[model samples]
Target: MSNIGSNPLIHFAAGATSATIACVSCQPMDLIKTRLQQSKQTKDAEKYSSVAQAARTIIQEDGITGLWRGSTSNVMRVVPGAGLYFLMLQMANRRYRARTGHAMTPLHALLTGSFARAATAVIANPAAVAKSRMESVGVWEYKNGRSAVIDVLKTSYTRGAMIQVLGDVIYSGISFAMVNTTSPFAQKKASPTSQFIVSAVAGAVGTAAAYPLDVVRTRVALSKAQGKDAGIVAVVREMLEEEGIAPLYRGVEFVALRRAITTAVTWSSYRAITAAVGRARR
Candidate 1:
């Protein structure tokens, strides 16, 4: 029960357009989340404390622009990835209905969203790598999005780099799947308010559960870029021993906040956009 338009082209355009706007609003939260994840300090110094503290630090150190670090690379995949995600999930729903002659159940939504997001994540992995690396406070020093991609590609063609890329993609895929599978309830509701609230809540739940993987992915990706590949197991093992599980969940609440805002805005905007386009087509 998705509200995305029947036309694939419209659906794609709606998703891309909506996501771009949402990204701008949500980027600051994302920046703090990334810093929290990439952070390596310990004890009291390790604390970001809250969103306000993290923002002030980033602004004081890197200026306001720092809050949007790596946004170019992020936008690169975000638009198309959003487009592909919605389109594929919708297609999956169609197939499910045709085959079973029933609406998408919660289980169906989970499975379809997971598979669809996994596909989008694989295709968008390079962008993910670039964003995470450039977002890390003092990691790779790519000039911009294009340079970031080229620089990563130089190393990413290697087996080690590819492994790191796959790990990041898988992490993103699962996290997003968990967030989006809750789309059914949101979409089922016709009101924009209900949709926003439900989607936002769904996003928060997913981010809380899957955020640790995001930290691991960022670390592994950066390590690989520096020609020091760290497998997921090693990354998790070392982080656990060195910092414990708490570190893994750092900045998670902020991520949940960002996810809620982004999901609410993106889906509401998407529904509005597609509806407008549909009306114009008449």
Candidate 2:
């Protein structure tokens, strides 16, 4: 059983596969959330007052495919990020149990989850930056995922680049870990029937708490496209000065709703993968 967990390949596979499943299922909501964020920041935000307005506006203005805009970049980041996140989280849980003679507590979840993401943040941040930029409405005119990647990479040489990209990833990790830990099945103790409900609640809570950071992440990703420096502090300062705090929570309602379902799907799939891997070794 321990052997399966030790295999880096298994962790990667589990993370990527589960993330892909979750991303595909909740993509439309993600798209709408992006639109809402962009609208709030822009001068013409009044055109869309609700989630339905955002969706309809995207369909009407950018076509139906616009609703899935930036999905490629989203998958690109989420697959690897989710994979790394789960692998680290699982490893942390194992280590925690070994050290404490019991399962992880909220404190353990908070610390381990933060550490896992911080460790993976360097690799994951660039992808996150790209995903958010691609998702925003009035940002860049990225022709495709490759172009967006190339464009973002062009700015990597700037000072404080790491801090800029990592700020939100760190916040996201802490939020997800803390909320996900609350799952009734987080200790992997729930019966099959109850896993969904428990995991769903956990996912929703974490997603909602972490949403403000997501909004900041998206705006920071767009900084370069808007002809500004791509530092987290600088962008944040500018946002506060120009747009105010309200912009940071622009799409919270839709994001929380969508991610609740996505998180449930992701976490549940992760458990199934872990179970299968463990059973295979047995």
Highest lDDT against the true fold, candidate = 1
lDDT for predicted candidate 2 compared with the true structure: 0.68
Q: Give a tens-digit lDDT track for model 1, residues 1-282.
A: 344446788888888889888987788788777667765632333435666877888888888888888889889868888898778866776777889997666656666666676677766777778887777654467789879877767766332244434443443344445445555555566567877887687667766766666777777776653446777788778778987888777777778888878877887888788878867877
lDDT of 2 by residue, 160-235 (tens): 3355345534555555555555554434564654666665665566666666666666665566555666567776
- Score residue 248 of candidate 1 by CA lDDT: 76
**Cα RMSD of predicted structure 2:** 3.3
RMSD (Cα, Å) of candidate 1? 3.6
- lDDT of all predictions, in order shown? 0.70, 0.68
How well does each candidate superpose onto the true structure, as a TM-score?
0.85, 0.82
263: Cα error in model 2, Å? 1.2
Q: For candidate 1, give the lDDT of residue 53.
A: 79
